[model samples]
Target chain A: MGLSHQSIINMQPDVQLVAVCDSTRFVLDMLEKYTGVRVYNNLSKMLQSEDLDAVIIATPSKFHGPMVRECLEHNLHVFCEKPYCLDVTEGERLAELAKQKGLVNQVGYHYRFVGAFQEVKRLLDIGAIGDVAHIKAEAYGPVVLRPSGSSWRNQRSEGGGCLYDYAAHPLNLVNWYFGMPESVGGTVMNKIFSADSEDEIYATLRFGSGLSGQLSVNWSDESYRRMTTKISISGTRGRIYADRQECQVYLRDGGNLPDGYLSGWNVRYTTELTPEVWAYVRGEEYSAQLDYFVQRIKAKEMDNINSFTSALQTDRLMRMLIDDSEREPIAASGDYQPLAKGNSSWWQRLTNAS
Target chain B: MDKVLFGDNQFFGVNHMSEEKARAQSMRFRDTQAMIDVLDMAYEAGIKTFMCTTHERIGEVCDYFRKHADRYPDYRFYPGMPYAHKYANAVTDHGIVGAIKRFLPNDGLMDAVVRGGSAVAKKEIDGIATLLIDAEMKMFEGLSTPVIFLQNVVTDFLLGLGMKDAFRVFADHVKTRYNAEPGFFSMNMPRLLDVLEEVGVENPIICSNINKIGFRMCGGVDLYQQILAQRQFRPVAMSVLASGAIPPREAIEYVCQLPKIESIVFGASSRGNIRQTKALIDEFMAVRQD
Candidate 1:
């Protein structure tokens, strides 16, 4: 949040940082010293005292719904973090409220703004990967390894586990492109991390048009540098394997790229597209996403790709995934006779199956 | 089960997410020889146990095993039953009765049917359950099946339905009928352990998803480790790569270093993947032994 505040001050001069708010006085005072802006210990007090243009809610997932609601009530253009709300219905209400007020509300799904992913959106839009059949989005990281995990993250109500927190990045990106899947089923496993929430999620999604998708998010493994989210899109024409830093496009039909970029794999790096930045702790993405939010607010653009509706859609998908997983999990294949291949008359069985 | 069990996922068209990959695999392994070739490679690489699903395709594998029994005396199968798709497809192609007939063991026809019918008639779930187990175990009749796992689809379903005792029935029948110790594979292992304990299964041998990442460990990874540390059930880690998200060396080292991991099960189509995975596991296992 401090990095983002520094980012706004460093990049967008048009959008001034009037004040900062935090629960801790030390944090507020430090921000006040750094930015030379008024600081408040309470968000409500900050809201009442300052004539603010906007609010950035980067608090815990539990607080997002309330803060966004309050910000929307004040008609403030808001940028909230992912897991837009702890509850989907609340997220829906906020998205609707933002819509009604014409507020430039954006969720911090920074992966969408990553250069490689942006390029993926372009290539996909241009039918580079011709009629997508399946998308496999995986984000694996060394988030938690111990049996007794970090406090709030393990709590299902607060952090919402790997499903709510980590998977949100890929889910946000996939939802941005595919909207909602027709149906979803898969299981979440707490294979090793001793948290109330799961360290892994193995999910399957089926779109109405028969586009099959799978999501795998595992944070318990110590193999990754950190959370490296990768999305692999398999289409009729070719395939794309993408991460934050670069994208590899395998074009069976090199229709999108220029001549000589033949029917083979071509690598595209995001580093070149990413503008050199001096501030912001987490690369150019945070700066880029924050700047886009400010620009949208300046332009009065109510409907950006990362708008409230989009975040709400992602949230709804998470809920759907959670529900579908319990009722109808897509188990890994093996050969065994179901004891209850019991007794069903052929007609009843056929009708029920259909 | 061997310390490293060669798996059947590649033969069965069960790529975790991509239908295209699954289809490609199905195509690649469409010929039975294609599968046998990979098995031969594994055997050459010193992997002796073929921990597999009882997929109908595996019948051919059993045939291959029977043919080469004299050559590879140490080669064995650790079979898991109720590979749900086999039954689902059987029902689709052959209907219920035909499917049941197809699955029923040759040695017992009227006896198995009577047991199945009496179970239904008496509401003694054990009878039909044992009958199905017998049916599923028929193909691996002569083959060495040291540990037969109850597939997760049925295990988790029964667990969800609160059918804890049925597991006991399965365990008992597996011991008595096949002279094999019953093992279970579940999406939810901790809960399954609780059910197992309730049904008097002490320190059971269970196969589940266990990796550096929880991948599919039911209950949390921490709880699984705690359970392992406590010396509860024996845990065979499957999906240790967490479906290819982890680097091979890192995944092998992390899991191999852990306590009480009885075995690690993995699948590979190419000799390269098989060899690489085996080398990593061997290196880690050697270090752990040291």
Candidate 2:
């Protein structure tokens, strides 16, 4: 949305700038300078006075549901930033009401619009990578706290912690790609960056397609910004390597490449968006989300971008991540008991480790 | 010499071997100087060797015993048989199975005989005999003092695969294997003595325990009287205070009333318990008319 906002301003179709609302006045002033739009401390006062087509909510987690609900009730199309609400039930109810009232809604997970990701999806659709195995993506931010070191994110009641804040983005991408995971399990340790939010999270997600993947997200890690996310795939034909920043594909050739050769022998594919995201913003096009909402308003169809079902499924995945991590470690047993049945083999005993 | 003395005639004394307590007390195993204090009290009360029942790392305990070999120059330290539980009960800090392997040198006949559910095969009986002979040679080869085989009778319950009769058969086999130079076997004082007689065993045997909670060694009064008349009886009085008729301070008084009693192995689960029992025994001797 950041780049798209600049693109829309550059398009300049007699679009007179209106008021902008931000929880922080500093960000509001910055947005005013960037877009030449007047800033409003309160959204309700701005909405009451100005004839607005839509209201974009880019506030903290706790306000997302209420802001979206108010926007819908006021008969304005809504564009909500990612992780529409910490509570999926609230997001679901708002979505249902929007559908009933025929309102437009768009959630701000902009990765689905990135051309590289779309290209990967296109390959999967065309069977470039055999069966759709699984897709994995990750994103992280600094310790989940404001500069003041005190905020709603630290309070459990506010629902703005890491499980809901940073992890929710990757989880949303997972849901968007591979449906819902069948059973999720792994450890979540509160290692270095100790807050109400989990400092370190390790999770294994098992999808119905029999493909499983592991994800690790933590603020307590040594590097300030070392984001590691990769999509590993396996099928009848070949595999694709969608690394953290680059896209590369390896194929089985008939005595084509030498054993140790990687540079020339190995086929390589690269994206232009590695250095900056502007190449993605310009060359690759996303449905102008605000325009999509306007189209939804004209067509009398409910926008399902942040629909209740989608958000609830994402929330379930988040709860699973938290649940698996907080479980206790097992210890050694003093005496052995007879196995449940007479399973006298070593393989039977190994199952107990699970 | 009483050819094949019925028991080893050895008294149990303080050996820092109860690893269960050692674990409950962790790296603090010997910290309270508990074993030393118990040894001092038992020594003053004329008790000789204190056999430790379990050990943390038997090698470390053996090392400890070897280092202090000079202090116990006159007394015997009979390390009890070490048997691995198929399922570990509790592990010491050192490691679980490593602790059991460390005490392999001390395992006696009964330790070898008990395997959780498999019946005592002829092979198992032969195995027990071999292990006992090996442990015996290892213990007594250099030392002049005889090393007795210490067997806890309760271990038979753990070998549920074998019935009492199977154990008897295994016992007879062990006796026959070691007939020329019988290894001493300790009993808890209430097993059917007929089995011991049936096997024609004369290896020195000590009934290390007396009957507890009023169950006679042999069933009927006639059988008890008849057996009491036929051969000599020895009792290592245990659980005398269970009825509450006997006080903790009257251990010696409590043992004399029991028929054919020779020695009293007082309850000493703790340092304080051992001290109290030793004091009671000393007090009883002071008042003895003999």
Candidate 3:
């Protein structure tokens, strides 16, 4: 992601790569040489020294809260990576701090900038699918294969698990569409990897008046590389499908689809879905996201799609689901029960089924 | 342990023939308490064993039995693993990582985590498979789980892929790891029996669809009958009503009359249905004994 940001920033004349920081000097030297950007060994020293309009934090997740707090205090527009922090309270506090400071703040959830998903949100806004009943969000990849590996991502203490590291992308996407869910349940921490953290997460969510959702993420799949996140929204009228590079829209006859897209299933490739770009990288998402963050800072815009508060909601939701799943198994839910079962006649079966 | 083991398909929505009925059954027992109500009905009617798919709700049911162990001292759970759709759902919702999470152990979790990590690193097939079984067995802690069955989706999928050794591994692990007998559900009983026999899983308990109407009775009904008569393995009749197409009396009578049939498993949501089927089974079994 840092490399991708460099590729994006290379094309943005307005956003200069002034300085970078890391404890590892070898990698830092390589990066400094490649981008001709100055390097600092410490974050605090770099913040005090660099003359910058904004700072992009690509640090480990456990430090996101403190780093963001530091950046806001420095009055710099901030762009931290996918997860803002390990838990909810820190995320909420950071978001509040950003709000009070009147600063432009964003989390690096790049999926929201994907062209295909943007179209998905657009179609949903126009009632293209009509009253989504449930959304199945899945992301699979062969990121971690072997049991023996040591990385921050494999540690639960570092806020590294499939849930926060990989599933956070799709969770953010769901938050984009549905806001805060009413309740989140189902397990989200089964370890397929030998890492301290889980390699998979499965969660069922309830959102706004009858809107249900399923979130699944797995990094142990041998088939995919990196990840392929796909969401299928089953709605009253039809369904919408979105992946990283392509989208499929299946809608009823009355939707406001323009041009060649008909009432039935319409397949769209990235070329058709993507907006015209001034700079193209491997994916337009990185370029678009960085551009949006920089532009917002220039315009003095405190509000943005991937704002701190939105990331906080997603962080809170993920924390809630994990906590709920880890709770003791209930002997009884004690929800309302059916009054009585009539005779198992064919007519009664039909009525009961409906 | 009981002759009539209750199935869990009725608690979770799983009707092979009709989505409408599956949904109805699903909605009817949406509340785990509703499931408890039906399960209580079955227990009170003297059906003490539950031959169940290890769906998420079964964990809840296991919790109930464990908490009130004294209340239902004789109750037993025959856990069926790889509740296939749950895995599919978990994979979809959590991806491979999240799906693995669904099977995470609440206890000895770190040991399992380390083993899972090392197993992946070592690519030890048996290690990973056993870890998964441990995860599935986590919910039945301190409860009676005398028999553990492999769900047919995995059984048949492995069979088709000619992964017959998986059956042996599961059987051995069930006996050695959990001190329980292993059961296998198959779509084709005759073929599964042959595979089990070849794998040296001797006299194993096997469940498959078997009824007079040949409702999903794969590998030919006569072949199943011939095996039932001649084979030494235990047979548990399932899908006996063919998803309620056949009447309860006829289904019970046919299965009971079959040679060497050890038990029958069925799912129903009502007390009347539970008692009605139990009475028919008791009547026919009494006659068979005579």
From the highest lDDT down, the ranking of the candidates is 3, 1, 2
lDDT of 2 by residue, B177-217 (tens): 43322222222132334434444543334433333322222
Worst 10 residues of 3 chain A by lDDT: A274-283
What candidate 2 gets wrong by more than 4 Å, as runs, is A1-16, A25-36, A132-137, A140-148, A152-157, A222-229, A252-309, A327-346, A349-354, B1-290
* Per-candidate fnat, comma-separated: 0.00, 0.00, 0.00
- The CA lDDT at B207 in model 1 is 86
Q: Which lDDT value does model 1 have at A136?
A: 93
Candidate achieving higher DockQ, 1 or 2: 1
lDDT for each residue of candidate 3 in A1-354, tens digit (9 for 90 to 100): 454455456456586677777765544654554335688889899989988778888866888888888888898889989787776787888888888888899988989988788888887787777888999888987766777545676677887777888889898899888888888776657888645878888889898789999999898886552367888898888889888656788878874665577888887655445554444434457667888998898898887989988888788877887798788654455784543677466877898799
Q: Candidate 2 chain A, which ten residues in sequence have the lowest lDDT sum?
A: A274-283
The two-chain DockQ for each candidate, comma-separated, is 0.01, 0.00, 0.01
- Position A303, candidate 3: lDDT: 78
Which consecutive 10 residues in model 1 chain B have the weakest lDDT in total?
Answer: B88-97
Rank candidates, TM-score, best first: 3, 1, 2
